[model samples]
Target: MSRIKQVFKGNSQAIFNIKEIAKICKIHRNTARRYLEILTLKGFLYETQKGTNRIFRLKTRDLRRDSI
Candidate 1:
């Protein structure tokens, strides 16, 4: 999880797809997608869909307000 968090720490405003996250974290695409879903549910991240694809961005202040 910290690996995922580290990705956000450097680019809080960046939006990313599962593929991007997977590459950044060096994890499998499915694992990255699952992590994204869990983080979205936990309010640690926000999700936006572009057509058939979903992208994610860090929630900024939400991170401080909520525990992962």
Candidate 2:
């Protein structure tokens, strides 16, 4: 599985920084940032930027089912 997929699927309450992803996924932090940007664009994640850091969270699952 892609690193992004693994992270998002493994933990429901996972909110992670690019730094954490880099460390855990063994990818460059810039690559982590790109994963986040793509997930955010796809509506599977949300980004909260504070200063120079970013915190990402999964969008609520209920929201996904409600659209059906």
Candidate with the greatest TM-score versus the true structure: 1
**For model 1, the run of ten residues with the poorest summed lDDT:** 59-68
- How well does candidate 2 match the true structure in TM-score terms? 0.78
Q: Score every model by TM-score.
A: 0.81, 0.78
- On residues 11-61, what C-alpha lDDT tens digit does candidate 2 reach at each position? 768788889977888889899889778878878788866658888888766
List model 1 lDDT by residue over 1-68, tens digit each. Answer: 77888788778788898888899899998888888888888778887765557888887654454265
Q: Model 2: runs farther than 4 Å from truth?
A: 62-68
lDDT for residue 62 in candidate 1, whole number 0-100: 46
lDDT of 2 at 19: 92
Candidate 2 local distance difference test against the native: 0.75
lDDT of each: 0.79, 0.75
How much is the lDDT of residue 37 in candidate 2? 83
Q: Give the runs in model 1 whose Cα sits over 4 Å from its true position.
A: 62-66
